[model samples]
Target: MLTKQDIVAVVVLYNPNKKVYDNILKYKGLVNRLILVDNSLTNNKYLFKNIDFVDYIPLYNNYGIAYALNLGIKNSTEKYILTMDQDSAISANLINSYLKFLNVNDNNGIGALTCQYNTDRNPAVAKKGYVKVRQSMQSGTLFKRSTFDKIGYFDDKLFIDVVDLEFFLRMKRSELSLVRINAAVLNHHPAETKVKKILFLKLKYGQSSEVRNYYKARNLFWVAKRYNSLDMYKGLTISWLKIILLYDDKRKYLKAFNQGIKDAKHNRLGKYYSNYEGN
Candidate 1:
């Protein structure tokens, strides 16, 4: 039986405002421990001092999400680590349910378990059951610490974006399981406006910024090179085709597409930003 001693929740915060802190407090009693990695330099240390459940580790600069997550993993002292974004909120039974799942399905070779994540609407339904996905969002997922020991931590080289995808692909190739728990609920702040949505998609799969373009293109190529499966290649092709047809900004869209191709050819991917400005 997996007890509370087996789990620890890790949240990485970078210049997170009060809302993020408030969100973390909601899960204070649910987990065995809460680990917070503060990647800010404003000396807001005192602000988090009052939160008894939080163990705040301060980094000098913005080390990006992937690096911070690796730091959190290093700091954690539990058998299982639940990774959550600072802005994420979980259901009351999330921790218990995940612990229960882990204890019973020990032979499944499961590296991570993702909850049904909702963004404004019912995004969870789109991803139901114990479906296997290439990437598991860092927020709303519980991971076995031993998984990291086997696959290693999130790739610090990718930095922020697509680190989840990269890690999950590695897990998949290694024949490890990535399960989605439909019962566990997670609420996320979705892109409400059309512009925000465009920007989100662009940054995720487009090439609006040089940095973003580099990563998107590079990562896609890397995945292709490493896996070289027809299914993976087809998925990539279809995704690019959808971006071209769905988004309105033709010039921006084309630019991103072309950049992705160039990066893929040269194997120069890492991270990229969309043209949309709103955060």
Candidate 2:
């Protein structure tokens, strides 16, 4: 029988709501252990008491997701570590299915396993069982402890966004595998709020939030610099250019894009942008 000692779920929470707590409860019986890293400024002691399954590690302030996840992973004592966003809810059989698949295909050099992330009108699915993708979203992904030992922890410099992509890209460069298990599914809440917040985020931070754009732009540059790969640089450049043109508000979009470029050039990252609610 697979015991809780086999797998540990490390979920990083930032001012999490009841929905997050409820989601954790749903998966409580499946994993060997549950570790919750609360990256909130205020102490949520009372809230932590209600969650019997999770071992809470409360941070006084918002330490970027990368930092929080590092803490969770370092503290965990399990063979496999599953890192996820607080907002994500997993299917009951997700963990069991992933473990079974892993056991049978031991030859597959997979560093991480990803589930289908449902967002907006489109559901992100893997083609040909598990395509060799350049990136994987932080939510709904399980990481092999050995992979971290090989690649080191996430870059703390990237505090918030694009950290997952940076980690995955590093694994890709090392020829490690990232598999997508179609049997596992995760429901994600898309940032489909009003156009005002969207426009503000684009203006203030460029295409994504300022924090996200900084990492996206800087990390892309860093990856190209370290790997000396023109293909990767070209792909990211095209993606950024597309975002710049996609916005309805040209002025705000251009301003944010310019700011992002300037920051990227200077390697200014980890600082939160104004108007961004530290997510």
Candidate 3:
């Protein structure tokens, strides 16, 4: 079975709140070393200064999620690596269960063993055994240390949104599978989302700002073009419709969405920067 020495944990931070410390405490003791990759505008080293067995890497700028995750992976040498977000936490029992499952299962073709975490968009349904999933969120997911060497690291070009899904799809392209450990629970707090009902149709919308909408649109198109998937286009179209119809700041969102499309077509990526907009 995998022990504390066999696992390294990486948590990406972005101007995290006090609750992040509480979340970090949940799994800090379960791993040999916990790495905090801060992508905040300023250094937050004081947060983990008193914590033992934890290393902090401050970027001093928002380098995006993919860059931070890759940096953490590069600095670790453990057999298994657990990736967590500032808003997610895992229990000791969940870590032990994941370790036990890894020890018993044939992990040759498994890209990652993820937890049954709930999301505002899609909540995980509990089941008796694990389920094979096409893609999964990055938080609360345990990856084999060598998985990157096999399939490659997360794409740095896409930046923030859909970084996890892009990695999962890349694993799929390499014939690797993602397994969700239904019994392994993780407390993952997604962005604030609300539901709207119109003529018997219930629509869920997230509190993603215009800047985030830009990434969502651009990355979706980029991934779709790279993978040649019509389903991705359909999904993007639905999101566009939702933003136009449901979002309070529809004009700003629409402008960002259009800019994202133009940039994607021109192959422009890796952090969105515009003279008129400040992010």
For candidate 1, write residues 184-278 as lDDT tens digits.
77877543323325544633322234344335545665566676755446656764665566556655655655666665576554443342223
Tens digit per residue, CA lDDT, model 3, 223-244: 8899986766876898798887
Off by over 4 Å in 3: 120-125, 200-203, 275-279
Report per-prediction Cα RMSD to one decimal. 5.3, 5.2, 2.1
lDDT of 2 by residue, 59-118 (tens): 988888899999999998787898888887776656866776777764437788877776
Give the poorly placed runs of model 1, Cα more than 4 Å off.
Answer: 41-43, 125-134, 190-214, 229-235, 269-279
In lDDT terms, how accurate is model 3? 0.83
Predicted structure 2, TM vs. truth: 0.82
Per-candidate clash tally: 9, 1, 0
Off by over 4 Å in 2: 1-5, 124-131, 193-211, 229-235, 238-243, 272-279
* Alpha-carbon TM-score of each model against the true structure: 0.79, 0.82, 0.92
Which one is best on TM-score? 3
Clashing pairs in 3: none
Judging by lDDT against the true structure, name the best candidate.
3
Each candidate: what lDDT? 0.70, 0.71, 0.83
